[model samples]
Target: MTSYYTIDHLPGRTIQLDGQDYLFFSGTSYLGMAQHPAFQALLAEGMARYGTMFGSSRNGNLQLNIYGEAEAQLAAFARAEAALTLSSGMLAGQAVVNWLKAQGFGFIYGPKAHPAIWQDPSTSLPTVSFTDWTDQLPELVAAAATPNVVIALNSLDALCSVDYSFDWVNRLPDGQEVTLLVDDSHGFGVIGPEGSGVGALIPRRANVRLIVTASLAKAMGMPGGVIFADPETLRAIRHTAFFGACSPIPPAYLHAFGRAQALYRTAFERLQTNIARFENRIGLSDRFQHIPAYPVFYTEQDQLYSYLLANRILIYSFAYPTPADKPNTRIVISALHQPEDIEQLGDCLYGKTG
Candidate 1:
């Protein structure tokens, strides 16, 4: 029988697991704002004002104003025309896919596309891999039976730590238009200025329409998923049956979300500092591409994983994309981790101690 260890306190860089404190490096809380006192205070204020749960459908007559406020703030932060929040990133991805299918758009998914984007194969239309799609993009666009075609991919792959630069947008054949649907969950709140994500790195173009979906639960240290798009696209998505049918995220989180923007900005700077320190201490190899803001480090060796775990460091060890093969151990760094903690980890990895 598989046994699970019990967590005794709130999660931070250090966590109490089964009565023992361990340095944790397996969480998605990149900015480490989940346990921030100020953020927690905002959460408490939200709870006091809105209670624990709204427990109502988004399309219902009774809707919280905080939801609109939070979305507006999110849009402003992301520099998008509009933003929408849902219960989870998976649900948000499904809703977008459903809307795209309804509009008769065929999909070309990247090699390392998230499973959430293509979960329901039955609804997917003329879906193809990125390589295949790239090889036949011009033909596909010219002879597309649908109104539009979409290239769906992640902004960054956690396992490989590679940023999908979306350079193909510029290389598209003249007179061909394709929508770019990106899941920026890994990049959001970690990369770009003020944590605006991959969209900040890539400028918008007239020929391409950019749609981004992300989960706030990671770096923002908040719950729910967010979609950033133009006002017209948002209006259309809001009217979708899936969007209206699903229950909205908690009002407390929405309220806290609006109030936590400044905090997120502050945390982002510290996180960047921590990342720089880590990189400086442990020199990265040129063999693998690295994103400074992304804390995950992937290695194929199991000895390193075992050594870290033996020293009470809990890092993520699993397979790439899935748990079938190609084992990868992921070591995550966060702003919550102290400089000494980073130094200690560096020592362990590089055998350097003073």
Candidate 2:
């Protein structure tokens, strides 16, 4: 069994373990907003105005204007007709799944999908690879009794650092009302031309409806989730008990998010620079699997994980979500990494000291 280590503080460029500091190259803080000075200042400003938390139901008699304003800003940012914010990304996904089930849409889950979008814990999904699943989707959709279908999948497999292509949507047969229920949790603030995620890049069809749900906690560094959809679709979801009964994300975070657009842009630029520098240092190597412009790099060598740790560097190396799952090892880069940090990591990677 793999034993776990404990940490007492938020992880940044470095982390302390056993009274020793190690270069921390693991985590989902892709944009490094959590430790960013300017962003933190904005967050402080928001808290000063909105306080720490807002526990009131969104449908309560008293409503905060920040929620609607943030939603509108998010919708505009994502290029969607409308967007809904939730307390967590998991809630956003479950809300969408519940709505899909109520509409009687049969599900076809894609590869390595996160559990957040599942109909339930026991819902059995195809065990085949993503390519095989896509190859068989057309036939399955054509044979189904009902035309309403929901394809639930992650935009990318973050554990393995694989970027899934959306070209498969173009091959789906017409006449079927297909809803692409994508969990863009990993891609939301990291990829796409404007950092809007994979939703805008998916192929659009007359019969296809695109619905994207994401956790803003990752790259966006917000303690919330969001659902992006067409105006009618979003309105229907908004009316659900799930939306009204649940408490919204802290008004303070949304307040900061609404005004931090330029800050996000600056962070993204820094992140891109870090990625380029690291890629140049690592070069082309078969020991790792990676996607261009993405922050995470995956490897199958457990020995490498141990090696990095021995060098006083820490990277992701553990089973995810469950202990039964295969262990994953990934080196995550972020905007918080200074050029010197990258150089030190490169030295360690090349078996150099100092």
Q: What are the RMSD figures for all models against the true structure?
A: 3.0, 1.6
Off by over 4 Å in 2: 1-3, 352-354
- Candidate models: Cα lDDT each: 0.77, 0.88
Cα RMSD for predicted model 1: 3.0
Q: How do the residues 1-354 of candidate 1 rate in per-residue lDDT, one tens digit apiece?
A: 112355757778887766777788777899887889888899999999989888888888877788888999988888777899998887787788889878778776666777657735543433554456556656656676655777777887777665555556666655656777888888888876778887876656787788889888898887789898888888898999899989777788888878887888878888888878878876765523466666777665656667886787777666654557766667788879888888878777777856
Query: Would you give me the overall lDDT of model 1?
Result: 0.77
* TM-score (C-alpha, index-matched) for candidate 1: 0.90
Writing each residue's lDDT as its tens digit, candidate 2 over 25-104 gives 98999999888888888899999998999878888889899988999999888878889999999999999999989989
Clashing pairs in 1: none
Q: After superposition, how far is residue 284 of candidate 2 from its true place, in Å?
A: 1.3
**TM-score on alpha carbons, each prediction:** 0.90, 0.96
Give the residue spans of candidate 1 off by over 4 A.
1-6, 122-147, 286-289
